[model samples]
Target: MRHLLAALFLALSTVAAAQQAPRIAVTDLAYEEQVARYFQYTRFQGKSSHRESERYADSDYSSRGSARSSGRTEIDYESISGDIVYIDRGELRKFTADIKGEMLKSGVYRVVQAKPYTAKDNEKLYDVIDRIKKGYFPNADYVLFGSITSVEPRRELNPIQGSDAISASLSMELVAEFSLIDTKTYEVKAAFSAMGEGQDMRLLKDPGQVAHLSRGKVMREVAQSLGVDVATQLEEQFNPGAARRARGDRYREETIERREERIIEYR
Candidate 1:
């Protein structure tokens, strides 16, 4: 009977603790990739050459010859170059999902969905501040802003020093920055940068086999790593000691007050 009562009390306490956790809204991951294009157009120019010679013979005049020649040549050419920004909304969503999943799993903060921003067809970037100003995270106490800084992938092949084999490697790296800001005050509570990497390697005796690298797997891993880093940093920057104290004080005050009201109602 004592054990059962204890278990029941513990369950209620756990629920109360979860309810006290701060609610945070995560925004879409912002990223942009620039692709430069060089275009050239060539057209043939219609040109003609003409030559004329005339010789007139007179009964007793010496032979005379005259020649005229004219030529024209032209080549039409044009070059156009510019950079275009490529935004993959689906990929960015996946990356944000990974971070959100990690944050949820950590249980450091309750996750809330931020209202999606409507973007125009030609828009290439999402602004976090504008979203906040527009009340995108109305229910959240804080907004978590994230952006991808850089992504780099490298592949290389090398011959073994003492053997006829060859070694191949593919490496992928991703870096991102994150900030936690108060929803009302707009003050940045915590900010930091994190990086994730994945590598695939293989050795072949024939040296002719194609090395296959898993890009999706690498990207997923990188995203998950970034999520973990974000969550861990949030916890550390807030200071666990202060958080625990705040939780304890709130729990005591709220629970005791509720209990007193219950007793009065029963009487």
Candidate 2:
């Protein structure tokens, strides 16, 4: 009789504990080709201009006889400008993973770390997150989701009109947004955004190196900030505390310092 009673109590405790935990689901950074641009185009005299040409079939119907088709070619020269939703696999992996990690560490809620996804692969957010919603984290109560609205890193190489010297510049800019929603009701609980930008200038034989560095640093730094921002917001909503706030501020300060140092070193 005692064994049976103890078993019942243990089962009830397990059930209670499970009930107290809330499941949260997160998705990858969503983006479309139109929005997935990574660089801004500035006219660099003869350097930045390029011609794009394409050919298509032009079919004509002859009133007297058979139809005739001829290949028609057109070409255009255009300068790239504005925000692009360029997808960098490494950049995105670091981003979504970090966000998931921070949410897990908060311990106030259960996070369902979602699988990898390419936003452009699916046309709709539901299409991107459907598998995770239906198969993986089906029991989640709330969903945290969003997209990479803009990703543009500036790397300019300009040759002085009068001199032979070339000036190289490195800069990174990334922006992401999120919507926290109640899964059952599909109501948006909150919306948030985070952005990161860093830049440096130096004369270099390989201007590409500067651009690469900027891309890497900006992606990682932006990811960190996004993770912290989301985690802090979640903390405030679920379990508010002065200590957590202080710790988060300290972390941000350190990140800013490191970012400054990295840029300054290139010069």
Candidate 3:
């Protein structure tokens, strides 16, 4: 009887251990491009002039029956003018990659590399959650889905005057917003915004040129800030240490329960 009981208990314990192990499915990570509108200003110098001329002719009857004198007058004027113009042009590239990399470092969730899809294509939020759940978790405790909600460029108009020209500079600011959804619960887990600003630089010639220079710096800052948040979130969500700690607590509980059972059996 003792042998039979021990065998049965071992089998049951094995099954329980298998059930306790977490079956995690990490679906492919998805990201949407958030193109930021950029503004820039430039100055130029040009010269123009106006001229007027008059002609008069004199004829003398006695001294010059055949002689004539002619005179001409010329007037010239020139001036310089300065202009300040505002322009909205250009775009920031490779924004999605920066966001994804930062999110991966956050360690909040297991992110898999998956196919690229847009929020428009998958309109309903639930559809995205369902897709992730199917890919990462046919049976899972949690599922995470997110998309880029908005990307807007904030411009601070700056005007500067020079001796020959007036120029305007666009102080560029890039802001990106994201929304996250939970699959099983079908709830919004989090929504937040991030921003990056580029250092002010005078683009001497044109807004387009200035935009080109400032965009890189702005995007870099945005990427850095985003990465920090992503790393923090990931750590909170899927850190191995958390799982280990939970298992440790469960083991302690099991030990206490086993001890109580043994005492009862002895009695």
Candidate 4:
């Protein structure tokens, strides 16, 4: 009888604990790549300037005439202009997948899938506010909003010292900002920026050999690291005074500043 009572209490306790976990709806990471293009087009003017003249002279013996002399010139002009372009890379699923997995693994929060808000015009909605209002994340207590602040990839090739082989390296960096917002109050509970970077290098033995860098590997590494970073920060920010007292705060702040830059200005 006592065993049955204890088992009932234990089951109830487990149920209560499960219900106490915060339910979070994590949306895919939003990213927008702005591409500014400068173009120059050379147009053939199809214009020709011609000069023609004829001279005739009459002398005592006979009349002498000179034929017409003609000259032509062609001109071409160049037109240069630029345009600001925006590319909407709907949702970065790779990063979001990793982040959601990490959060789930942590067991701190109950992670839920957030659906996309399908607008009537078929335009994609990247904003969390619109998604929440449209009932994308149903029954979620809070929404985890993420956006890609910046992504940079670099490649370099240089001669190795004291060797005939060339060293080729490829590196990728990703920065994203995350915010946990209360669904009812629409207040931001925690907000922070996270970054991840990865690199790969290889030595080319043959001079004419093509060096292929493992771009996918590098990006996967970045995504994994970014996921861990986001989960760690989320946990830290939720704890009172944890983020402020953390030793990595200064470094994170500096990274956040370096990764974000304003390129467009509107008057």
Candidate 5:
């Protein structure tokens, strides 16, 4: 009876271990910088300027003697000025600033306000991954990390009319490249590139507005790609029975023996 009880306890322990959920560490996604350029109208040079001025002249005379008295009348002149307005560069700058702010606030991707990473900064990618893993999943079975490999921006010119006259407009295209790595095997898991484009509407202005629009679009694409890749990786590493147990599936007495048999077969 003592030996039989010991064996039963051992079996229970094995079953418990097999039902434990596998831990996976998902590192922060890395992405390349994306740029978009658009022409924003800043100032209009042909607008009219106006000024107004007023003038007054007056004269008065008086007699010294009380018997004789004299009075003089005075006249004044006044003027007002007005002018029609034209488009200017200031308008373009304001519009561009508005667009840029909107894009940054959209939160489609992690936007970097500063200059992009240099070749020397490439090491930071691995460092970030390692730090995240250490903090979130010290004993995790799998760690996924990646980095931004490249970013290229190309601009094309178009022509449009401004308040002053015809001006050159710009359209920008951005390309981004990313690479995924497996921490355990030190192997590259996936690599891909994405591109997005934006057009500037203000022909007589700054190009920053359209650039932001393009960046936002690219960010959305990057996120979708990352989701698909991560899903695939998880599927590959998943253990079916562990997943079911983690999801709160109960084991039946009859199926318990079959499950044990399958686990043994897989092991």
Candidate 6:
């Protein structure tokens, strides 16, 4: 009888706790490392510069029936910026800082913000778990760790010959890895990876200008979408058995038995 009462009390406590909103802390995504990683895949075109020169020397017609050449000098130069993806080269604020605010806008998780952390790109899962265990966010039940693993930006330029103008189209694809770690148990409850793409185009004298203006817009927009997806995935992970329990499937379960052979005799 005592064991039965104890089991009932524990089950009620679990149900009560599960009803509360979960506190989630999302760390910053490493921005600098991701940008450097993308540079590795960028292939630059060779002989990116073009130069032309023409020179003619004046020569008097000798005693032959030859004409004299006139003096002339001409020069031309063209330089194309190598396949460099020009983003604001300023101090790369932690992607984590920006992403955390974006995640909060989703209003899906009870997101908590902490003082900016100095954790670098090399921060590991164990290190994150330790921070949470040390009461980094006292109310947080889970800490989300994320980093940008890959980014690919594609740019297309088409010159409209009529008006001396160029049309530029830019697209960026980003892939990131996110982990949700439980504070108490220090177990990675979920690992979620998602790819998001953003695109923008512009018509300007220089095709390269399109990317300069559009890169920030695309990445900023992608970050918002990325935040929502991560939050939704973590919510599902935190409630793995909620769907089954809600359907009255788990509530009716009896003693565990070999499911392959045993059938419920008294359903």
Candidate 3 residue runs with Cα over 4 Å from true position: 1-94, 106-109, 118-126, 133-144, 147-150, 154-191, 203-212, 233-267
Per-residue lDDT of model 4, residues 55-143, tens digit only = 89998999988877677877877676677575655567777777888887876678887876445532445556767777888989899
Residue-wise lDDT of candidate 5 within 102-135, one digit each (tens)? 3223321121221122324443544545544444
Evaluated against the true structure, the overall lDDT of model 3 is: 0.48
Report the lDDT tens digits of candidate 6 across residue range 165-250: 88788888878888888888888888988666777887788534543556778877666666567656666666543553454334
Count of clashing pairs, candidate 2: 7
- Quality of model 4 by C-alpha lDDT: 0.76
Q: How far is candidate 4 from the true structure (C-alpha RMSD, Å)?
A: 16.8
Ranking by TM-score: 1, 4, 6, 2, 3, 5
TM-score per candidate, chains pooled? 0.67, 0.48, 0.39, 0.65, 0.29, 0.51
- What lDDT would each prediction earn against the true structure? 0.72, 0.62, 0.48, 0.76, 0.40, 0.60
Looking at model 6, residue 129 earns an lDDT score of 60
Score candidate 2 by TM-score against the native: 0.48
Please report, as a residue range, the 10-residue window in candidate 4 with the lowest summed lDDT.
258-267
Give per-residue CA lDDT, model 3, range 153-239, as digits (tens).
555545456643224344444454444545466565555555545443454455454333466666676566655654455455445
| Candidate 1 residue-pair clash tally | 0
* lDDT pick, better of 2 and 4: 4
Error of 5 at 166 (Å): 14
* Model 4 regions lying over 4 Å from their true place: 1-15, 37-89, 117-126, 239-267
Candidate 1 lDDT, 177-240, residue by residue in tens: 8888888787888898878777777887885688777777777777777777877887778533
**Candidate 2 lDDT by residue in tens digits, 1-267:** 345544555565445545565678887666644435457664533323335455555458533334444454545456876665543332244477778788777655677655555345343444424644555446677777767778787778887666656677777777777777777676776677766555666664543544233556556776777788778776665542345445555655565567678778987
- lDDT winner between candidates 4 and 5: 4
Clashes of 3: 10
